[model samples]
Target: MTPADMPSVNARAGAAVEALRAASTELKIGVARGTSGETVIDAGGREVGSIAAGVKIAEICMGGLGDVRLIASTATPRWPWTVQVHSAHPVVACLASQYAGWRLAHGEGKGAFFALGSGPARALARKEALFEELGYRDSADTATLVLEAPRPPPAEVVERVARDCGIAPERLNIVFAATQSMAGGVQVVARVLEVALHKAHELKFPLERIVEGMGAAPLPPPHPDFVTAMGRTNDAIIYAGRVHLYVSGAAADARELAERLPSTGSRDYGRPFADVFRHYKGDFYAIDPMLFSPAQVVVTALESGESFHAGQVNLDLLDASFT
Candidate 1:
């Protein structure tokens, strides 16, 4: 398909930008203009990232392909926001995850920064394996990215991003959220379902067969320390997240896929992510690849209307990790 025929992540995310800026005060977020003239929305960096801001960030992450809702959680009252996501365009939404997901690392040294760069700009870069597999690309004059960081990117970083997206710096829009803050937590937890879809893709499932997807996870309280924050966000998915996918493939294939989709399929399944992180000595790539999946997954084959389920939520592990 042509670029014009495809959905634009920047265009969809841009709609939320105005609303986010308008409610900056109510959402406890700060908006600023970068030296490179890019628009920057601060979630947990210089300002406190509110639940509302997190919701907006999550929407941006999905390229607005899906709906994100903040619901009350009876399971974890302390972490009140239960993030729920639903998408009719499952493949497109998953493409959004690949294009703009927080999978990239940027900058260098103490002056360096790490960001899960999301939005349509990734298609322009086409640097990752997922992008190559999707056989998709996007073209737009303006680029949008959601960065998980504690501070606004440096001028050079902004310029680099614009360059990478093949756009002028002034045309870039970057949103920032730190992992150790409320906005960061909400945005990260929001990916519980997306992560599962990505895993299915990794396992070589026919992504186009997925017609609908929905997922939910408890929002963990934000932490000031990055490691602790990472742990909590991961535990939310590994121990408590649940996902359901409606697919148009064979029931047996869907069932087989479900059996291999959850975090329990990995060797690193039993511990809090922090401990696992330490065990791997902070090399994210060294961790069990399968451990990145959701705690539970259910797939319904549209052809036969049969539901196949796998994995289980380990509440004990969640409590241990959260505490």
Candidate 2:
């Protein structure tokens, strides 16, 4: 499909680049101009980023396709910096979450660099099942990506990304952050809503029926260690994250869907995610597929004006996991 015909997560996110640049110094983020003239924002890599930087990183994670804001949490005083996210275009936002997310691995062997590809560019790649299922594609002169790694992506990796997006190498924009950094934690926790949407999709829920999506999760403190950081981030979502989705569907269907939308639905519900990850020997796919959901989910059917709620936040588990 033509660029205009498809949802442009990159275009939406590109609009915010200037604002991020203008506040780079204040946000404690570093902006670098690549040789191809592509703009790269370093949210955590080579910089000690702050919470403001994390918010921007979270937005970038959604391919700038969703709205991310900070708010206070009523769940607990321990986590005050709760992130709130909403997307009118939930399908596009979720697509951005997958395509532009940290799911793709680039390179092999010693030189191989694993990066989470984000941006409107993933629409052009069309490599994953979600893209085909959505029947959506995007075309853009410039592509953007967010890499959850410490260093900038290699030149070859950038070239490969540009080629996949059908754009020149210079027309690429990349954002980098390490998972142990402040920006990394915020961006991952920001996926609370996305996780729910993905779970719904996995369960064969009607994507078109979802009209609005919103989610909230406490922002855990960032750890310099990667494993510790990953654990905390996952715990924030699986144990304490809460989400609400508005759909245009039958009330009964919405209620049934709600019953399956929380992390508790998984067999791996009680333990902290870090322990669970180790239990699976760090094989992400080996873990319970149902565990990758939010702590609570509520679906409101607009047609019937009936809301279905399921799941509950386990603060005690969250405390143990966070500690």
Candidate 3:
């Protein structure tokens, strides 16, 4: 817990990569090296990808600081499973490591390849402004990144990532899944806690005061279409994600945070996320940024032992998205 005990996110993620490699066959995931020598983990894009493999990728996405568990549940009626997540180091694990903030692009038009790079590799790249705000930078001989894409990254992108991280292309690792695959759905839904932490940071809440965090969201079936699958994964959290935080702050601040943290606080909260995306003319940046958050939140002030709850799960919208 001291400055001297600084943990390297990349180091932790590298360990997770080793574990994933050991169990790739059992998990039904593919493991290969990229043309650029970077390691590529095929989790959900191929015919062999499985939900269990996606769970491992989710862990790596948080730099091994978070726990992602699958639970059998009928609480949502439509979903038989739920993804539970928690992190003692929410700020570092979720915001610094898990958030998909790095935009990697190559080529153009039909042959174009674009993906938001998320995971410990981000700490090394320090490409996003959020890293500067966090005042954190990770260094390690090996780096790992998580991508939500339909295919393996191009050699150019892989080399770019390797160069940006100041590591050999052979030392870089990428875990990618198709957004329309079941493994992808599980991994995305597992980001419920990270989404909450990102929204909290966006609201200017004191990140250091957030001591503990946990969240859960129903795991919807993946759709065949990319956009629809994206919608289903997002709706899982926007409609029914439940997040709890133990924060060391004034009760008033906790209450205020709870009031402002839910997806309902956004003007774009009435319908499914896809509908809103279409309303914004398919421009993700054009949509309200505040709309990306849990549907329900309970912020408990650790100082006063009081909890402030805000927003309610919207089953009406959940039903609409799941079917």
Candidate 1's C-alpha lDDT? 0.80
lDDT of 2 by residue, 177-284 (tens): 888888878888888888888888889998878888999999888777787789999999999999999988689889999999999989999998889999988997
The alpha-carbon deviation from the true structure for residue 263 of candidate 1, after best TM-score superposition, in angstroms, is 0.9
Worst 10 residues of 1 by lDDT: 96-105
Model-by-model lDDT, in order?
A: 0.80, 0.80, 0.89
The C-alpha TM-scores of every prediction are 0.93, 0.93, 0.97
lDDT of 1 by residue, 291-321 (tens): 9888888999999989999998888888887
Question: Which of the numbered candidates is closest to the native, going by highest TM-score?
Answer: 3
Clashes of 1: 3
* Candidate 2, pairs of clashing residues: 100-117, 100-118, 102-116
